[model samples]
Target: MRLSDYTRLLALAAIWGASFLFMRITVPEFGAINSAFLRVFFGFVGLAVILLALRCPIRFNGKFRACFTLGMINSGVPFVMYCIAAQWLPAGYSAVLNATTPLMGALIGFTFFAEKLTLSKWAAVILGAVGIAIITTFGEAHSMQELVFGGLACLVATSCYAVSGFLTRQWINNQGGLDPKIVAFGSQIGATTLLLPLFIFTSTTDTSIHWAQGEVWASIIALGVICTACAYIVFFRLISDIGPLRSMTVTFLIPPFAILWGYVVLDEAISQGFIFGSLIVAVAVWLIVRPAKQAEEVKALQS
Candidate 1:
């Protein structure tokens, strides 16, 4: 990767890593529904502005179903799930739980999409699940039942993300090289539309439109513009250059960074189990990406 690419990687990591912190802090002030609604609302506006500034074609040729479907899976449902889960689960733990996306993605691919799941992939998935269980089991045990429930919420979020991957592959990828900016644009709008009722009904009681603190506004803007809009741009660029597996390596590091940010900002405790589980999760990512590396090498050799 070039220096520019490295820069993009760091920026992407920072933007995404900080999103967990933002969600953790901001969700309490604004209810999850409001926070999620605003994030998507501002994200839509930010992307729309960028599209206009860059003179990118924003034309929608009536592929609303495909785009809207992906929006719900890729953005709408997962965002709401993550937001709700963030209420009960620690941000760092939520981030760690998300590290399971590739494993879940692999399973979804194999089961539904006819992608090959080799022995290595299955082994990696098992190890990753155990790693997550370690963290889930070890965290704040007011009751074992609560921990289990929290853990299940995280798993549900991961599954949402995983299924979204297949949705993206089948719907977006097959659409004659559709511009991802378009997808981003569409997804945000779709999410905003879906959240409209919740915003209207629930937000009236639990949410405040007034920004009491500048930090809150900053966090909201950062989540929308930097994390959502700019981060997606960097993400698609990385995927274009490095392929999805390499690009998605960000997932492994995100939890650690989220944990680190939480510690620095919120004085969140980092347990031994969290550390051990993180290491195991890292190993699982290495295992999953190994085949993608091999595939890239083979392609280079053939070329």
Candidate 2:
């Protein structure tokens, strides 16, 4: 990989890592649906402005169907689930569970998408599962109930991400490669539309809605512009340059930043179990990320 590609990967990691912090800040005040809705809405506006500034004309055909599917699986459903899960799970724990996205993506690709899985990939899945088990079992000594539920939510969210990634790769290849900005815009717009009604109903209670807090606005703005808009751009660019599996390395780094934000900003307790579990998860991801023949074949097809 080129230095520039690595730089983009790092930037993607930072943006996604910070998403946890922003969600933590805003979700409790705004409610999950409203928080997710505003985030996608702002992100759509930001990307739309960028596209207009660049004078880039998007070729939007009947791809609205595919785009909506991607948004539902990628952003809409997963974002809400993750935020809901975070309400019960620690931010750090939620993030660590999210690190399983790549593994989930790989497995889904191998099964449904016909991207063959080698022994190495299977081994990675095993290791990743073990890591998840350790984190769930040891991370909470008193009650595993909430943690288990959170972990399951995270897994479902990760699976959603995996499906999204495969679909995106297909989209890009079919279009002879597209501008990342356009893809980002389409997904954001789709998510905003899909989530609108839910936001109105779920966040109706006055006590649940805190639209006045400056922190809430700050979190919204940061998540919209930085995490959603810019992060998606960086992510697509990274995948285009380095391939999807390699681009997924960002997941391993996101947890540390999430943990840091939780500790420094929220003053959340830093438990040894959190540290140990995080390490195990990271190692498991590394095992899965090692180059696989099937992934290599998929990359070749893309090229």
Candidate 3:
């Protein structure tokens, strides 16, 4: 990867790491559905402005439906799931759970995409599951139910991410490929569309939404404009420049930044279990995603 690619990767990680903080701030006031809907709604608006500013035509090349469906899987569902998790899990805990995305990807690939699962990869999967169990069992929560549901919500979000990655490849990337910006914009449209009815329902039904706070709106805008809109643009560029494997390294870098932000900004306490579990997950992810040539060399040496 070029130096510029590395810089973009770190910037994307920082931006995304901060997204959990934003969600933590917004979900309580807006509720999960409303917070999620407003995020994509503003994300759509921000990306539209970006396209217009760049004079980029908004064409999906007959792939709008696919992009929309991808949005539901990738953006809409995952966003809501994470928001639900934010209600109970600390931002740091949620971020650590999200580190399991590649594990989920590996499992989904083996099961559904006919991808290979070597012995090492199977060990990685089992180790990743153990790491998740450790985090969920030990992480702080209001109750056991909250801890279980919160952890499960994050895993569900990551699974959606895994599915969407493949779908993006099959539907968008492999099928003549759309511009990343256009794909990002269209996906936000899809997310917004999917969440609108749920947002409306929650707005009508939930009496606890605290809409009068200015900081909540500020966090929401940052979540939409910076985290979703700008981060997607940079992430797509990284994929274009360095390929997905290298781009995936951003996953490894997010947790420390998230943990730091949680500690510094929110004053959340870090426990020994979080530290140990995060390390285990990180190691498991490396085992799963380490380059094929490197894995081959290690096996050859052992043989």
What TM-score goes with each of the models? 0.87, 0.91, 0.94
Which pairs clash (backbone N, Cα, C closer than 3 Å) in model 1?
Answer: none
Please give the distance, in angstroms, between residue 2's alpha carbon in candidate 1 and its true position after superposition.
7.2
- lDDT, candidate 2, 142-201, per-residue tens: 478877887888899889888877787787646576677777888888888889989877
Instruction: Evaluate model 2: give its lDDT.
Output: 0.79
lDDT of each: 0.74, 0.79, 0.86
Which pairs in model 3 have colliding backbones?
A: none
Weakest 10 consecutive residues of candidate 1 by summed lDDT: 239-248
For candidate 1, what is the total of clashing residue pairs? Answer: 0
CA shift at 147, candidate 1, in angstroms? 3.5
Model 1, range 189-229, lDDT digits (tens) per residue?
A: 88888987887887677534565877877888888888887
Worst 10 residues of 2 by lDDT: 202-211
Ten-residue stretch with the least lDDT total in model 3: 237-246
Would you give me the overall lDDT of model 1? 0.74
Cα shift from native, residue 256, model 2 (Å)? 1.3
C-alpha lDDT of residue 14 in model 3: 94
For residue 42, give model 2's deviation from the true position in Å: 1.1
Q: Please give the TM-score that candidate 1 achieves against the real structure.
A: 0.87
C-alpha RMSD of each candidate structure in angstroms: 3.2, 2.9, 2.9
